[model samples]
Target chain A: MNEPILRIRNIESFYGPIMAIRGVSLDVHPGQIVSILGANGAGKTTLMKTVSGVMDPEKGRITFDGQQIQGSEPHKVVQKGIVHVPEGREVFPLLTVDENLSLGAYTLSDKGQIDHDRDLVFSYFPVLKERRGQEAGTLSGGQQQMLAIGRGLMANPRIMLLDEPSLGLSPLLVQEIFGILKRLNDEQKMTMMLVEQNANAALELAHHGYVMEIGRIVMDGAADVLLQSEDIQNFYLGVQEEGARENRRWKRKKTWR
Target chain B: MDNAQLLISGLANGCVYGLIALGFVLIYKATEAVNFAQGDFMMLGAFVTIGLTNTEYMGLPFWLALPISLMIMGALGYLIDRLIIRRLFGESQTAVVILTIALGFVIRFAAGLIWGHEPQTLQNPLAGKEIRFGGLVLGMEDVAVIVVTILLTWGLYVFFSKTKLGLAMQGASQNQLAAYYMGIPVKRVQGFIWALAGVVAGIAGILFAAKGSVDPTTGLLGIKAFAAAVIGGFGSLPGALAGGLIVGVIEPFASRYVAAGYSQIAPYALLLAVLIFRPHGLFSQVRVKKV
Candidate 1:
């Protein structure tokens, strides 16, 4: 029964004149991982962008930490401690890895705390320390994603919004990334709102999940219950066998109240 | 004057051109818009020095007046950014360029009205003093230009490569949005860079005036500086200097041997050739945009 840290009420966003996101609402509780599962063009990225203040929503209210944040500038939003790791791992390509990390702490004024966070980020991604002098663009896809997340951490945010950390990574690397994410959530009790196309994987890791289809949430429930449901099996989990569906139905019935 | 002396004079002039080009490149890197008023800024700096040194006015010594002029020009640059350039933020690239061009006209016309069209000579403390060095007679002013240019260029190199503020400016130039996310106050950095460029241009103007005369029409130095910027690859600081020197040296040689009438056009011709052969300029880093 913890209070929610973020609330979105009927928010709609547009790109120029074209409506990209319809009235979408969700809640992210304190110290919980909430996953927004969707296919491409389902407005998942748009929703994250709106929350991070990159795109202004045309309608609805977004409250973070009890303050209305809709339509705020991106930099101001960042100062309020909602750090966004944007899509495409947009790390400053020309900057050295260490310099990139320093930029993440741009809003921070304390020299000691900035150094402490730098150490924390380096420990989380040991490879970053090894390649701190190299340009960020020189890193591999998995390493860049780690840098992006590490960069988000540098903001000392209350919540981290990650957009497809698995995008463009190999299966093994994706697994490694998700493992780190789980560790951050479980060990540090860090709050996260992850937008991912990998629905099965995202649902498996999330405490609660919301399925987005064409700019609206179609299904939302506890992750375990959704994982056992027949609808999720057919539409998201890609299970077609009759025997498997029957077993999933039984598990759903048992898991549901 | 011997051929060697003419070559030395040309080299000195080239150094001034390079310094002004550096100013253009510095501002262009930060804002991505050429301040067409760059030359007028230089002219203003010289005028301020002229006013300070005039017997009827404050009549400050040349050494004191020089720094004061530079400081005033830097402040003027900061004011321009706050008043005009900042308003043009998020404007289309073409609109920004056109606005700057208009600003250039405004500045030049204003200077003409204020100072009148007469060319005035700046009194040189070391005027007519020439040093003989193995078949080349170098004027004291020429030596001053070379020494000052080298020192300024060196200072700039250290600032960019070593300082935190310098790196932040570079980061802002590369990606403004990303720079802001990292906590760099992008607007302040842009203003600082404009001010820096103004100071550099001011130094160039004072030197140029010492060697020759200062008139409202001296703002034409901007066209040569623009050519230098183009030659250096519009965003590269060192490239601007190199480009200026190239134009400076080549124009005089062209005037003496090739065609006196075409001397003024030499830099433009080089600019056209560079554009055709190497669009990025001789020293610019090639930038690739992501989809």
Candidate 2:
């Protein structure tokens, strides 16, 4: 759709001998938030890692802006404008917040432009500006997540692959982070591919959603349709009164017997 | 030699050790792997200077020859990084260590073949001049060594703390993957560091040879430098210099008061004690990794 900005065709990834993702295919268009919803160990992180060039796919092609980039180095991938904010917020602990932000713009040649971006990032996450002199490790989970996002922004990426930005955060922080993500998508028109276990939040934010189970896509549709589907209601939301009533009847019959 | 004269000689030797140890610390910080060939690089630099000064091909003055040798050695370091060390990037720590050791042997043998086995003296402008302070006598050559070491150390402190490139190098040293993501050309920074380390080692070699003789066997001095690095804290820059000083001061004292052979063993013993007590060294900052 609309000349997919990133196209993943039949990607299979392995960790040594064990296959992590099998025949996984996905597409992301410009200026859209596409979410892959799955439980833990369902290849969500693996897919993100593969797309980011941290992990090499054994089979299939990854075409970014119509150019093959299946086995490129991670830094080269960043240069081509696909910045991955990896899971668990892997910020350099010892480096100051400002240093971390500066590192994010490592690829940009213009110092003036980088400084502008730095100011822009601080505006987006004002708390980072207040704590710019502090070591990154000293930041709380929510702040670290914000710093990670700000760092990604410094890269000036065309597309951002965010792997569970809300992980290990308080509910309040999660809401705030999601709000920022929405703002980034609407105001900046930033394209994002988000992998998250927060199914409800993910469905609410994503334009389109793919439901993954056991390393394969089980359901793919508009987020609203997926949210309203009987299958999803039964499996994820546990809204099956009919099944519960039948289970009680069966229990009664067994007791009588 | 009297106690005061021994102290002067010891401090002079310590300054040389400190300089070489500085190189070890710099390269190790940038690459996270000890370049075992560091000593051989110093040997090469000294011989390069000797060649330029002695041969009619260059006929350059000692001052000109020194910088030229440093440049040549720096180029050699850059080449080594491009041709060899870069290939070993992201390899296991053990593999990198072994690779550098192999590189050291190659450098040593190469220097031996090129410069021949004979020991040669580098002519110094103040070879015989000594300044006596009360009971203590200090040679002009020793003074040069102390001054140069102090200046270089100060320069390096400013470089790491105040400069952008230095900060980038420090960032790379601490977390290379993160540094790469930030847009630092990690490879280029590493190459620059290796070249810089070579220049430091070269300066140490010239200073050392100014006081004594230079030969292929001089590369073995790296072992003492390595000892200094271990004593300092493998990762600490200041620690390397202090470690060098300790080794320098202790060796002469041990030889005089203890036994002649004991001086050689003193550094190793100090290294062992440090490892057992403070594994990070006296000055190195502790780094904790998240699981």
Candidate 3:
């Protein structure tokens, strides 16, 4: 098999004294969309933070394009072409849409290329183009999410680490964004690691997927295989077998623990 | 007619106050800490210029001495940010505030030890020169003060809006972490901001010293400048200039129309009124933090 573009092996990270990610491992190959699915407190955000150099991993190795990048600063991580779209759409609220996108290309010296990429981002979300001069804070939740993603694209990232792109978005908006994500993957061959709680949407678009629970990956497989799995259907997809509805609560408690 | 003359004189003086207040506003925007030592920085600028111009010292011409002193003060400002202010960062706001107050004391005493307690006059090219417009007489120093303040303020406005480095500084001020994430060298940008503030302080000092005499305690005028900042809006630049003008005009008018005591209390009274009514100042935008 070809080498993965990004790899995390036996990585552990802590938030103060609390261990948020405990010896988790994952691989994202070139031109593949990898999704990590979990509930709240499942350490999905922590894993993304460690990869993007926002948080230091206490143990194990993180390599990007064959370079050790576990302890690098966030800015250095960007220079390596790995852009992180953090949870909650951290768009610079006061800056105009144009300025935010301009800042996203801050590391690049080529002004011409920066402008070209900005045009590309505008094509992906025409609304951002229309409101390009307005403050990002004035954007709606879904538009802000689009802006955040558009800002990431302005960096011309080789790979994107997206945390909860579907959060606080309507179902139709989620589908629209996911469609864009799929297009980026298919046409541009962009590698992405998407961490999300929206399992069905994420799994539907991802090439491969991992299920995390309590800072550990409990299951991982090809997206189609996981979607077809009875365990995934019953637990995550909310599909219960006939005559099994009465004992479902007791079964869930036993299975989760 | 008397009010018109007072207004002109007050505006000139207000320009000086506004210049000093700009330093406060700039540093506060960058670090969120009010550097009480900012006045002392201005004092140092004047002293450095005087020292360099003295025959026993460098004895350089006014033009030569000016840039040299400004560079020296800028470096001092950079060092202060790196060695002292940076260490106090992420600590409580009150702790940083008190540290700056202490810094002011240290700078004041250091100036006294170096230059002695007596006041010294600054040689200015425009000193003792005046232009007459009809019956009114304007001091060359007053005109210099107004001209220099306008130029400096305008220069700053251009720098913030037009330059890439200035835009980076603004980005850092708004959100340091986000700026860092965007691959901006935030630490270096912050150091540059401090150095730039220092350079501004030096220019203000020279202009101020040209008007009269300078001493170690000359830095104490920074208090009134602080009042100007509050009157304008703490974080706004144009507000600082406008605030300074208001304070400057009111003081001279109050002393002439009301009493000498009223001049002394005028700026503070206006400050209190503003705080009681429109706390955001005349030109400040009201920023709301989102959850």
Candidate 4:
């Protein structure tokens, strides 16, 4: 019943002459974790890009916290308290971890507040604090991802768009990271829109879930509903049964186009 | 006076080359574009200083005219980024490289038209003065050059590591897209970097003019500085100074011991040798881009 913090309505995005996303609509309410699950080339990443103002959509509207922000640049979008932890964990390689964290608070001028927020980040990722003086490229993959998320947190964002935090991590590490994310959301009331291919882990953590196929949302409902559905189990969950494989494939194939 | 004196003089000249090389590395770091017009900017700075101080031109005194010329070149640098360089965003690397080379010629010819082709001496407070110690003698200007170069290099080092704005510029230079996502105004930073490069080049130009004379062809000195940058690991700040000193010392020593013609090609030969052996230069840290 809570009002949505971010609302998307029939948004279409294109790369050159090819359409990357079409009529993709979703909602993220206050303090809720919403996950978008899709395979490669299904436009999941493109949706996050459009929402974070990295690319302009050709049609429809994107409203973040009740303001129209469809075509704004990434820096302007960040000013509105929408921090994006982009895919591949793009940390500045040559910079020290401390320098990276300091840059995250670029908009803020208050030294005291910046220091306080940096300490908070250090608390969340103790490894970052210990390796603060080391170059960011020296950190392991898991630590770099943590630093990327921590950098996003330093901005004091109202909402975070996380793209594949567990892209190349071990299963145990994925669970560990998702556990931290859940605790942060519960304790600090942080809103998140996660794009993921790991449906089981994502659905276990997120409150709401949307299934994307070929640049459009195919099914969306409460996380439990989507997780329990028989179709998601066969295709996305990869727990396919011999009896239903052919019928499900034909039905899903028809719905795709 | 002797071979030792020649070495000392060569080292002093190397400091000037290093200053100009710093200008090249500054613009290259910020925008990833090798500015071919860097030497031309230095040439233009000297001409501007001379014109401002010339009684026939603006008639201002040397002290008053120098600062004004620096300001003018700084503004010119900012305008170059805004009016020309920005349009080449996302262009092919070759196109941008060629454009800058072409721009260097344009500025050089424009100076030729305005100032005439004749060489003119630049008036300065330290002209023709030297200090004698034992059998060795050093020009006052050489001492000034060495002292000023050290101070400028130290100042730049502190600015990059300590100050907020300088850190922001460093961060942006490393990754502009990431910097933008962090809410750093990257375009404005690019403009500031270009202006800063211009001011540094102006200082080097003024010093070079005072060392001898300014002519339209003076900008060709940028080529030697460019060779120094390549030897120093193009993006390394301190490497620029080291490379310049190496090039400067080698030129005079080669002419004195080897052949008179060897002076002109010594830096180029050293650059080639370095590129063949260690392409990244001695002090450069090799960076691998991650996906």
Candidate 5:
């Protein structure tokens, strides 16, 4: 019951000469919200890209449902039921919202399944159904982000890799989106790997959380445990007690890699 | 200038340019490649029909020859994409642009070898036919051009805006990386676009040949068609046709009223004007993202 659905072992990825993600390992179990918390330049997006087969890892292995899938093409990875919702919500600006969602279901040949998936997406985000025919670019940033998420849901993916869902949104919108994500996880039992810089919002919603730094995972535990840890509060949660930073620096010596 | 007569004649010629511009826009949209060989594809389409319908050749009826010629041209476009364009996929677009420019010369030479350099016309049922309405006479060939262009425009519009595959293609064209993430086979969609461009080029050639004589050099008209595409915002579909009509109508009127030589340069002059005024061209505001 505890078996991980997606596993990565010491995967390395490069962009030309520079290594973007170096020797990273993580696991996402079924029907759980796994959050990777990091600041900018922490290789959070790179990890998502590598797992989705958008970037072929230079070394190590990625197994999804016990099958090696590290170097498969993006479309092939999608066919195996992993959908990547990219950073910056790159919905086709000129295309209608309906068109974008239909494209997300590109791997599905069953018309009935596609319709069902689209209906589910609309139900989750009723605003999407209202603006279905409108060009995606015309939508507000928050609406576009929902459209991006709804578009990803069109695939009926086994595990969805979400890159910064809270990015560039108002705090209220962030809470709204995370609430929907929590609902999706609980009601549909949808598994998700969420990468975020919004540690407070992400930690609140995630079942398990990992803190990443400079292309490596520095700390990981149950979301509540990580939230309560003194070192995490000082570093990620930005709690400032007298000499808390000094205490974190001292504690770093004992933290596991 | 006789306004009604010139308008009809101009519209007929405009339809041919519009059809050719349609090919340019179709290919350019799907793949960022600016195919300099589009005109030569047009030449090949006209020659294929001539070879089929002419008395000295296969002598197929015009109706039968039309579809057969379209299929042949479509196949040629697809093969060109699979063998040549696909090879140039990761290479700089300049490589493709140069290759297609060279292909234009090669295609023309091949057509000359097959059909000879002398001007040739299709043996068709529509030849020399005319329609008279309130003393406004129009060639049946001109009428056919207008009718066919409308039908093709409607058909392509429906295909692109309404169908799943078409929407996928439009998505792929706008952003390949995002498109790939959505499980679109971007490369395969591009190949289909080339095939479509070929079919469109064929239609333009058939209409042009029906209206007048064609030779190995007839492909030079592609420059005017290219100008039409520029005048229509390169990012938009409907803009392409409007651009073509503007160029086509300006041509005869420019010659009749302004001067004879002006007709040849009118489209280019208008193109320059559009570039100065609306840099993104008319209709569409989106600037095509450069690779």
Candidate 6:
């Protein structure tokens, strides 16, 4: 598929002696939204951290655009056009919204380009425009998520890695943000690697989807196929059989089940 | 005019203390460490200037000697971070605080060895000069101190708010990991902050020396500056200056009017009062982040 823009092979990352991501491999092609669906402890965050060089993999090869970037420093990785919009919306609370976006473009040298990128981000999340001068801490949870994504867009990244953009937001807000992600993918042809627990929304917009279970990938397929699969419907999408309530403990499992 | 005279002198003293306190706030905000060695940097700054301006030492002109001393102090600060503080990464902030306190000792000892235990003053063009207008009389040195301190404080406020590096530094101070994600070199920015604090200490040292005499023990003045930082609300730059001024203005009045032996406790007394009443000092920053 036109040589996937990011290639991760046998990436084994750890938290000290505890292996969090165990020899998992995946690919994300250019101009495509690839969603990695997993439960809370599925190592999705760790995988994103490894690719963005926040946490170095204990053993693996991560090549972006055919250059090794597995163990590079986070800033160096950013210069190579990999932006990680980390979980929990870690915006600089004391800084103004404009200031936060400006810092996201810290790797870029051209001032004009920075201004243009800022304008582009403002267009995507016009609410951020309304609160450009407000301190980021004052933003609502939904707006903070938008600011986080807008900050990533300020980088003009070749590929953006988003860890749980739908996290800690209302379902309505989640739908709105996912709709924007869909728009960005269609309009700007933005390449995004989205890690999410909201399987239904993520798969609905993603070009391809992979289901991860406890640090390993159990299913990978076209988004539509994965959406219709009985395993995905039962486990991820929570689409139980007719008149069957998903109330039991230890009821659903992964592909193996 | 007697009180006016007292006020002018107090303001000048407060300016110096505030300048030093600014150094404290700069370092604390970036690294979350109380740099007890900050006053030592000031002492070394004055010693360096004295070494340069006095004919018996470097014999350099004041103009040449000033920038040179600042650069030297800046390098010392950067080196301290690169060589010492960076290694303390992943360690507790308390460890950094203790390390800085120990460094203060080293600095005091080193100054004693290099310049001798006797106090020395810088030979400058401004000392012993005065300005008089109407009922108020002010020392030219004091006037210079007040004017320069205002300028420096304003400059720092602008730098933090207007410049790109300054904003990045602020972002890094607030969230180091997110700053890294934004492509900011957080560690190097921290090193630069130390360098900036060093330069500030040097300028304060030179001005303090011009105002009076300096010895190995001069750095202990940083203690009062620390009090000023706390009084300034810890996070606010203007607050630091106001805190310094508050401490400075009270000292003379306390010694002149209060009971004997209590004059020495005046600044600390004011600090205690402020802490008890304001709690967040007279000026808190950014309004608790709107949570």
Highest TM-score against the true fold, candidate: 6
lDDT of 1 at B267: 83
* Off by more than 4 A, model 1: A241-257, B1-8, B61-64, B123-136, B256-262, B287-291
Between candidates 1 and 3, the TM-score winner? 3
Question: DockQ of all candidates, in order?
Answer: 0.35, 0.34, 0.53, 0.60, 0.52, 0.65
lDDT (tens digit, per residue) of candidate 2 on A147-206: 989999999899999989989888888889999999999988999999988777887888
CA shift at A22, candidate 6, in angstroms? 0.8
Using TM-score as the yardstick, the better of models 3 and 4 is 4
> How far off is each candidate at the interface, as Cα RMSD in Å?
2.8, 2.5, 1.9, 1.6, 3.7, 2.1
**Of the candidates shown, which would achieve the greatest DockQ relative to the real structure?**
6
Model 1 residue B60 lDDT? 90
TM-score of decoy 3: 0.93
lDDT of 5 by residue, A36-155 (tens): 998788889989999988889999899999999999989899999999998888888888899999888988889999999999999999999999999888888889899989999998
* Local accuracy of candidate 1 as per-residue lDDT tens digits, B137-246: 78899988888899988998889766778877878887776676555678999999989988988898888888888888788788888898899899888888889888
What's the CA error at residue A42 for candidate 4, in Å? 1.5
Question: Each candidate: what lDDT?
Answer: 0.84, 0.84, 0.88, 0.88, 0.89, 0.90
Q: What are the per-residue Cα lDDT tens digits for candidate 1 across A169-212?
A: 88898888899899988877889999987778888889999988
| Segments in model 6 whose C-alpha atoms lie over 4 Å from true places | A242-257, B286-291
Ranking by DockQ: 6, 4, 3, 5, 1, 2
Task: List, residue by residue over B1-291, the lDDT tens digit for candidate 6.
Answer: 788888899899989899899899889889888899999999999999999888889899989998999999999999999999999999999999999999999999999999999988889988788788997877888999899898888898899999889999899989888998988988999999999999999999999999999999999999999999999899777888888898888888887788656656988988899899999888868544322
Q: Which ranges in model 2 have alpha carbons more than 4 Å from their true place?
A: A230-257, B1-11, B55-58, B89-91, B129-137, B161-164, B256-261
Tens digits of per-residue lDDT, candidate 2, B1-291, equal 497788878888998888888888998888878887788787878888877886533567888888889998888888888898899877887888888788778877887888788898777577889887787678899888888889998998898766778878888887776676655678899999988898898888898888888898798899998898888988888999998888999999998899999999998998899999988887786755442
On lDDT, the leading prediction is: 6
DockQ of 2: 0.34
Clashes of each: 0, 3, 0, 0, 0, 1
Q: What is candidate 6's lDDT per residue for A1-257, written digit by digit as tens?
A: 69999999999999988888988999999999999998888899999999988899989899999999999999999999999999998999989999999999989989999999999898889999999999998899899999999999899899999999988899999999999999999999999999999899999989999988888888899999999997789888877677655664353533433
Per-residue lDDT of model 5, residues B160-244, tens digit only: 9888889888999887888888888788888888999999999999989988999999998888889998999875779888888
